[model samples]
Target: MVDDVADSVGSVRPNCSRSWSNSGSFDLRFASDANGKYPSKIDFHQIGAGFGGHFWFAHTRKPGAMGGKMKVTGTWTLDHERTGPMKIMAALPDHGAHTEIANYRVNATRGPGGRVTKQPGDGVRWVSIGTYMFDGVVPKVTLSSETPYGTGENDIAFDAMAFIPIDGQYHEHTVEADALFDENQNIDTAAPESWLNESPLESRERLYNWAMTMSDKILSMKNCDSEVGDCLTPHVGAAVANWRSEVMAAGKDPINHPDGNSISSWIGFANSYKDRPDSYTRPDSFDDDSRFKIRTKATTTFVSDENGKIVPGSQSASYANRTADTHLPHFVLELFRAISEDYKISLPDLGYRAKDLNEHNGEYTSVDPLRSGIIPGRAYSYGGQAPKLTTYTGSGEQRGATCVAVRTVAGGSIGYRTLLSKEGPTTAMSDFSDTLSNSQYVAQSVWELVENIREMFFDSGSFPVVESSLYNVAPPIWQDLNFRACTNETVRKVDGYPILRASWMPDHYLYHNGTAMDQSGALRKTSLPLMRGDFENFSTATIEVAHEYTPYGQCRAYVEDNSFARNKNPWGINPVPRPGFNPSSVQFCSDPDLAPDPEYSSYDVS
Candidate 1:
């Protein structure tokens, strides 16, 4: 079976979920200064201190830039001088898009001689805990010791890496459904014709410049006003070095190249050199007439120019792991931007500013956690009530609960009116419904259609009895339906006939009946309100009750023989007439006597 498929059309695989799985295993070692404890506070220079007793964000080796599932295996060993007992703990974020592969724990058991080891092993007792997937999120690890540093007892040595499984990484983009509705194939004219939003490269230069500025900013942060290497320094240094190396191999002189000694100076400064002079550039020839070139880690064989077109024969200036090289700078910029405020980094030029990074302490910062993850906030809810409404409309001055008229097709005259309000306390009241907010009206309507369809095909019992196995098979478009928990329990067609019984909220029922509000089953409670469409309704239609059949999966022909004695107006605009109907009259046609007059002939087949 095709698990998922995306097309140019708006219809998409509604319920399919994407995630990362563990690829392989690696290790983590933590030093005292990196622990953020006393004797070494995480100040400007101590970037590692920020991750002390907490998590630090970094990249992995196996997956490279295009991320995936990562299996993290490592040993957590304590490096304390006088260790009586200590706690060694490590963790990966279980929030945001990053899901924990499994629940695990590591206990640091002190072996003889103040030596800590894992259970059931020798030489530091290595324990393998996770088969994790970071997806697009930057991987982070957290560490803590029973006795923290500067206490003369707590010190930790952590060394770990993630092995990204190459396969479980790619995710298909979700389609933006704007023009069409999922049910009745309705189209909304106000919606844009095209779902795709084609954007120009408006922020290309700004983003590039931001990356450069971030590179500079990270280097400028000083502890005690002295420059020092932190976790990110090496990456920038390596990138610059690689870029400069490519320039030189292209036979470009360091003094004359546009990037010039700038990249070189950055590299040298990161490496603790006061300044790098031109003598550092080797005069050796990089050219070889032979087809084979010197082996390097570069992934690309040709360099691209400003327009992104390949520069002819510019092999020497080509980049390796081009995808990683392309995105690493952006990652640095975004990561810093997430926590920049706490560190006193200036905004205005960073494109966006974030509130609190620690709010997502154990979550994936897949660029920005807030953009992908939802944070639930509580709203004060007080009870109120509204009296029964008296309505004067096409439906005979209906005086009852609230109902809404929805136009299925844009600009068409007919509207489908469905009863929505529930019968409850007399006092005025308002609350959030299962349909969610105003923006979700379309999704809620679509969900209602699917819910009714399921009821018609399976619970109504009006059609031929489908095999029980068929009932288990999910409908193509029904996956998006949010059905009620009590639906299966309450819907039982013992008579083997249409559940015209005053309540079955079936699709066909919507065609000829109006429903009342009732709640029979109440299960779990949540912050979000229950969907009103989920409950069974109250309608005063004639019910042809049938006896409970003896065996299940009895396939029989649908209603095939009726005297055509009566017919009802399919539209609920007028009250349907009731006739002396035969309970055994198994026919698809409605009673002819109740059919609508010529003026109100048009009806929707629900």
Candidate 2:
């Protein structure tokens, strides 16, 4: 919430300083600027209606077509600004000609008039550029100079742009976030590569603990309910796995790849090199990879005909020709690695990511995925197939907005938030408000994705066999139990396959009536950071055991499981409630009428 006025902010550092000539310019603001135009204690307008100042653009008379005949549009831009197309609003000048300012170039026709915002999280201005979902290179919206009639247009006065949250909550109260951010202002000024000397990648106490938390959620098999805590079901694991693969395939992720640095090998890499341990988590290369770092020009996407969605492939502008790119050769390999372990979640492929397509793309006011026909927003990855998920994004960044006749784009996202610059996983993570928006976006998108996956499996007309754990009979899905069941071998199967439980173990998790997990019960116990017994050999140890155990990292999953589980809930069961193929599907050990098999297998690799 920094005031545009230079003097208003508490302090200006080298990274994020502002120039206040109190005049006008052709300068575009970097919305992703790690150090954005800070606000002052003294609100200029005093009424929260607008941010501190404005950008007044008066170009030296046009030379050609937009030539002297029409007044040229001013250049106020937000580079690396929009993640996906959300509602974009601008502070309209006291004049009438510039009502429509955003890049979309929709007539700026005033709708029943409520709020529109841009410059991501500034303040909801008066008009809009509608809503869109782009996945091209670096997301940007330069409020180009106004040329209403190509002549006789009024001078352009562009004030701050604001990002309207999907919930329409404009005042995010940055004041609170500001103080918290100030506390973390301590920056690490070293080159990113030098951090390797910081040591002990494998035996990191802090990172190991964090890794355990992630592992717990995976094992929890939490339902599709956000009302429940973190949604880390097998479905989520698959989504994460798939997305990680996608980024890597795009050549985006390099360092934290499975083939390279096992996350265990470098979870706390940056923390080790931190100048001040207490500072905000400075990612590997904040200075070099920030979206706001530096870029000479803003990249261009397109101005679609408002009627663009009604036709087949109605990209009336230029893309196939110019091959316009938001990210050349696909992904921006910057921030994808910065927070790989935490935010990016870019681990090596777990070998179980399924693809399903669901779309939620539309106009801001008419975009209702739950209520409208499912259209795919690029982020929704509709047609993106998972088989798909948007588990993380911030408010106003994409999801939060109004919509009109929900238009389903037939493909996947075609936009990337960048310019000539790159983003660190820590880019948006730095600011509290941006972080909040990002998380909200991720939550909504992921929810849509996971739910879509569930529907896809159910609709496929076949039972879903997510993981291989030893639990129940094949058809009855007795195998959704804890991984420990893998040791017995009797009930270890997924849809009749003879594989040990490896990936996607939370096929149909059961939440017993009481007691905390890890404290008791067979299927719901806590997971060990490392495997047990002979598996200990995988760890940094020289143990002499009677039998050599298999390390989890090297565990093998021989067969594919497609078993059915009773998923019947109050919603009525078609595919049966989760984890219930049949009544006789109980593990031989858990079966009341059966006796334990005389033969015992000590280990289950995966």
Candidate 3:
């Protein structure tokens, strides 16, 4: 923001020592007549440099032709002023600078609004003129314009008093008076070379050039600009050559030598001169060439039989029989431990173990040199069960041991899989039926719990009090966990992925339970211990419901089905029982026929 220090009228306090005046013409005066004699006032003039300031004009008289009238418009600037002895014949310097002014003319006609609208005549015509004036010190300058007959003639004058501040203020000065003219004329011509020819070029150049030269000289005054600390002349080409030679001589092998490789040589040269000329040299050391060598040592270990000979396993002859002894058992145990830790479940281990083999042979007749018999019953048969043992082998025979092993216990273990539906009932179908039944039981238990909570809140004046009384006087422990799980599920679905776990559920549940219990107790003026007990029960029930309902696939399916049911019958009149059975309902049955009436069914007696 530029400051608006000058008033709207453009006035400034004048210095008492300065004398100024303005003639009605385009002339101005500034003088200090030390003689104190009239007409002896030293003068400063305004030379017509060009038109700039505001100006106006009026016609002298109306034209005979209605629209054939000439009007003038102009602007001007003072160029230069002259000052010399007033009437001295001593050939005093011309002592005056040039000034100029400009104006324009156009034909116009009067319009209904008293407007002087320009006619379809010549465009604004410009006229420029210059003048020179002198007094003993500075001269007066003025500008005037004359229009054609019947057109107005106007004159503009600049007040020397107003300009006194500008003259008295600080301004750039030039030694050669001619320099002022060159500036006014907008000339780029350099100062006369004659002055340079008479003096040293070093002293004649501009300050900037002098500073640059000094910087360059200081930079080049030092030595040891090479990597080997070798002294070289202050030139880039020579320094690079010297540094390269030093690096090549440091090694006997051509490929290994720093200068023998283009990249290394370039890097070495750059490092050598990085800060050499301007300051102390600091070069980087080269990398050791041995880093490029490849290792030939083997990283893999192999297992062998008792006879120190390879055994035949599933697909090929084995060099090391990991399954024959310790390897397979160790690896299997490790895998079991890892799975148990991951699933947070424990499993009992089988006593028998086998070794990891580098190769396998499917032929049963192959002898096991280490063991007495042929692989010691490589195929296990229990209760006449067809080979209950699992063979761990890879496709390629000679590629080494199988990275992993498969364990086949006598009876199948608990595992997760998608159950396939069968048209006809079978043993597998029965097992799936059992699983489905269990899932329904769990789902129904959770849904009933939620409905009970909702109903309690609706029926009781105090929602928390009812919730506490129904769910063991514990705080509303499950609200935070359920809300967070719901929110997380939404976020995961929106991000195009499935929600794996509700990591924040436990903490969220605790926080909300505490808050609810505290607020309820405060409102009811109940004992803290009673409130806490109530809260604890409510929280426990809520958490039980949330935990059983909010697993990955379970939560996603529940939300989808609930959302669908809500959207289909937004009025909440849907009387259809949920997919899973509700243990809390009086009619707790698995039959769909005995379920609650459909909320949207038209089979009504009305």
Candidate 4:
């Protein structure tokens, strides 16, 4: 048999070999304080300067100037620090140096001579950007720069890529400088605000909406079959059918369609119908006089106390008796009635016999008079009750006696009495035989009713006798019907015959006898891995259930005629095992003539 199928589909596999990139750039500005010290003499004539082994922008004249260059001077300091966590020990002193450079644009006009000039058409503009580094003790500015030319006169810009370390790796962001001005050549701080607002960040709502639309489209196109007339025509049909089967197999319900209106209203409606009450009509009675009833009898043992008062002992037995009155029998009868009504069949009540009891006395003589001179014994009969009800009373105060009584009420009731004895005392009562026997009779009557109803619905010949063996009961016989000997063919052809064996494995047997131990001493291991390996080797093992028919000429039939024997021998059966038997091995067959060539076997050989 194939391995049990999984109850639900597994999680969707994800693509492992895919990659993507996120790229963007931002513009920023810088600010600095004036009066900062310059390390070297300023060169206002040139457009660049070398300060502390780093390049810096110097003020210069605009194009079309004749001889003199512009001179712009400004002092600035840079501040920088890393954000987020760092692996450095807090106990140790932190020493790091960071630097920022300012870009300045010079607004000036040259003079006639080849000498430098100082002029400010727009007030000197300064914006800083650069890098800083630090040792274990204190931070120091590593690189700093400022634009030498003022805005509009000559555009001066500062550009740097900031590297931020994440997960022990650095991600770099390209930063560019944009000079913002207001008619004058001063730096504007609001230049950074617009760049910050346009930062690269994903929107969660857009992603959700896209996923929803894709899922709906996938569901819509799942199993579209438009050609076949009787097949599920639409893709949605196949998808829903497959989904419903999966949900049912997993012991779950399908997801309900969302309401076009408010979800709360739909939820409320669903909750209202979750556990709606069921309506059942009252059951009919088997007999008009019969009624359902419960009868209980409590038997208590008492011991004499020191004060001569009877005290109840813990050792006592309570018997609860229930009789089939109109309710229970009516319920049973009503089940058949309902089945009959639903199937549009008629059922007739089969007659039943009442409870019966009888007794016969016998006499025997012995040699010893005191021990057993004459022995009197009674044999109880199993038949209907006698006309007159009788009650027996004991002659001695403490003597043993037997009492038998039957309740004739439509609904049975409990009748109990206390017996007291001074020496040896015992009491015997028998009434449940009738009650239990009546219950069985009622059950059989219901069965007969169902049988008749079934006969009405199905073809007369098709409705078999429904052998009691199907229910593990003895075959029933009708007193007026003739008994026929069952032929072996008839007995073997019967269907649905229940075997008289244990249906469930006993706990002890299952734990000990049924469990198989592996080489590692682990119990209850399946041979799935071994079987899978075997299949992988041969590449011919079947993975699904399928059918193959053997021609009638290729098979043989055995016959047996001894119906009375428990284990009969079939004619034409061989006693010895068949040829090529291997108890501990799996067999694989291959015909050389039918097999493909080895070279082409690996390619499209199915």
Ranking by TM-score, best first? 2, 1, 4, 3
Tens digit of per-residue lDDT, candidate 2, span 1-606: 112233444222334444433222233332211243322111112121233423343322222432223333334333333333334444544332232212323222221122222122223344443333433323233544322221223233445443332321111000000000011111121122113222112223333343344334443455444443344434455544544444333232223333323332122111111211122222222222111111011001112223221111111110000001111111112212322433444322111111111111111111222122122112111110000001112111112111111100011111121110112211222232233235632334343432332221111212222221111111110111211111111111222322122111111111111211221122334211111111112121111232132111112222233221111111111212232211111122111232212111001100
Model 3 spans > 4 angstroms off: 1-241, 244-261, 265-289, 293-297, 301-606
> Against the hidden true structure, what lDDT does model 1 obtain?
0.19
Residue 299 in model 1: lDDT? 12
Candidate 1, position 525, lDDT: 28
Between prediction 3 and prediction 4, which has the larger TM-score?
4
Error of 2 at 81 (Å): 6.7
RMSD per candidate (Å) reads: 33.0, 28.2, 49.0, 49.0
Top of the candidates by TM-score = 2
N/CA/C clash count, model 4: 38
**lDDT, candidate 4, 1-606, per-residue tens:** 000111131212233221211122222222222444332233312212111111223332322222222333332111233432111100000111111112222111110101011111122221111111122221111211222122222222222122221122111111000000001111111222212222110112222233233334334432323332122223323433443333233221112323221111111111111111111111122111122111111111112223322221111111111221111112223443443443233333221112200011011111111122111111111011111111132121121211111111000111100001101111110111122224422323223323332222211121121211000110100000000001110111111111010000000000111232221113334411100001011111111122121100101211233211111111111112121111111000111112222111111112
Residue 429, model 1: Cα distance from true site in angstroms: 43
Q: For residues 395-431, write the lDDT of model 1, one tens digit per residue.
A: 2122231111111100000000000011120001111
lDDT of 1 at 561: 33
Q: Judged by lDDT, which candidate is best? A: 2
Candidate 4 versus truth, CA RMSD in Å, comes to 49.0
In candidate 1, where is summed lDDT lowest over 10 consecutive residues? 410-419
